[model samples]
Target: MRSYHLSHSGAGLAGLTVRTHDAPVPGPGQALVAVRATSLSHRELLVLEGSYVLPVKPDVVPVSDGAGEVVALGPGVEGPAVGDRVMATLFGVEHLAQRGGSLDGMLTELAVVDADSLVPVPAHLSYEEAATLPCVAVTAWNALTGDAAGVRPGDTVVVQGSGGVSLFALGFAKALGARVIATTGGPGKAVRLRGLGADEVIDYRATPDWAAEVRRLTSGRGADRVVDVAGILHDSVRAVALAGTIACVGFVGRTAEPLDPRALFASGATVRAVAVGSRAQFTAMNEVIAEHGLRPVIDRVFPFEDAPGAYAYYAGGTSFGKVVIQGAGSPAGIG
Candidate 1:
């Protein structure tokens, strides 16, 4: 089996090196999956830069999102059968009942995963698209629909940036019948955001006061839910409606400013910090994705050997959606 490991932590793609290892057989209650595709997230970038709060062990597999087929099952594995398409749950076994567990990332050609941690992929989606769902999609679902912020029909949602979480938020909010206002950095992404179901797209670069624009678009009511993937907490506080919810999903902005207590009090909005989610949440998200026929937005796909290049592209920050890397064992037709 071939795997990409984070051999060193630095500022560039040089840290990730491909290495060969003997594939292992699964133990009881586990399944052996031939990895088909894996996707990158901003979290991985932070890990590479040595800025992430969670310490990644050296030589660890370094991507959280992957989809593959179950090739074999160990004794007592009674779930997915051979040939069933499955995606990994980001968190490891212990996190299924708790919060804040670390992920055993999936950047390998083959993985032996706990059978309970795998979710069946929808029949309509390709391997690459399914690979995008485990992290961003589940995180978006957890942020918007989880206990932190239960978005109702007719509510208004404000999603920050055109990243995976923001785009998934747009799609989920629209599916829930909420009016979505999305913010992006430029005009080109504004058009793409609208096409992805954002009712109004704000170019944050042009209108630095995007919170005011959100208020204007909402006729002064402000947004009921703000998916703050960019970590612009102050702006999210300003744009959120009174008693609304702000789901803090990312730190892409690298902002260092402390939250103003006065602003939070004035808005009366709840600020919830979201982790990716549990196996239960992942399953629920998959159900919703299948129900809505939601095909994850994929900006590009790279071959397995070009995994480092995939990280480089993601670091360049121009991708409109999830960037996937196809594994050596991936079906040739998928992409």
Candidate 2:
């Protein structure tokens, strides 16, 4: 089998290389999945760069979001049947506790997942579409409704950037009957976000203080929830919300700016920091995606062998949604 592994020198996409390796049989309680397609996000770059909590050793497999079919099962495994399409969880074993840096196991041509960690892809989606859901989708789901918080119909929600997480957040929020206010640095992305059910799209580049614009749009009450993908924009996120709920998920903005703690007190707001969620949350999110017939926003697709090129493109910020790599020669349902 062929796999893309990280080089020892650095975490850049250049460190990712394709190599051939023996395809091993599954062990006890495990299932061998033939990967159909996989997707990319900033997290892949973090793992390659050795910044992820569960840092990969040199030559470790290099992606997390992938979908495929179960080809073989190990002893005691009765979870998925052969020919069943499935997606692997990042922490193939961690079902509960927040998987920190220790859960680094999902990117490969044929991943051996535990029976408990794999979930069936929603019926309405293709393998490529299912491949894009696990991490970003679950994270967005967790950020928005994980706690079973109140996000009533017609309530306003703000999403920063149209990247994977924020885009999924926008869709999920809309599905719950909340109006979404999306922010984008790119011109076309604002239009695209609006088309994705965002009631308003703010160009943050044109209005750097987009939080104020958000307040203006909301008649100074701010939004009910703000998906803060740009970690540095914490203050701005706080600035625009009505009374509570700021979900901080990404750190696209590199700067660590100071924020006024008093703002939260004044606004009576709640800030929640979310990482990619658990298998349980992934399962729940899948149900919602299935019920709503939601399709993941795909920015581009590259050949599996071109994984490095895909990573480079992801780093270059040229894509509007998820960047994917199709498994070379793999069938739609057979990994």
Per-residue alpha-carbon lDDT of candidate 2 for residues 1-335, written as tens digits (9 for 90 to 100)? 88766664255666666778799798999888988889987777777666665544555666778888899999999779998989887665744321112332445677777767789999988888888987888889888886556677888988888789998999999999998888888788888887888898889889988888888899888888887878854565455564568878878787858767776677777778888787788998889898999999888888887777788889888788899888878665322
Best by lDDT: 1
lDDT of each: 0.84, 0.78
Model 1 residue runs over 4 Å out of place are 9-12, 96-104, 332-335
Model 1 per-residue lDDT tens digits across residues 219-257: 998999999887889888989999999999988887736
> How many backbone clashes are present in model 2?
7
TM-score winner: 1
lDDT of 2 at 180: 86
The C-alpha local distance difference test score for the whole of candidate 2 amounts to 0.78
Give the poorly placed runs of model 2, Cα more than 4 Å off: 95-107, 148-150, 240-242, 332-335
Candidate 2 has a TM-score of: 0.92
Collision pairs in model 1: none
Clashes of each: 0, 7
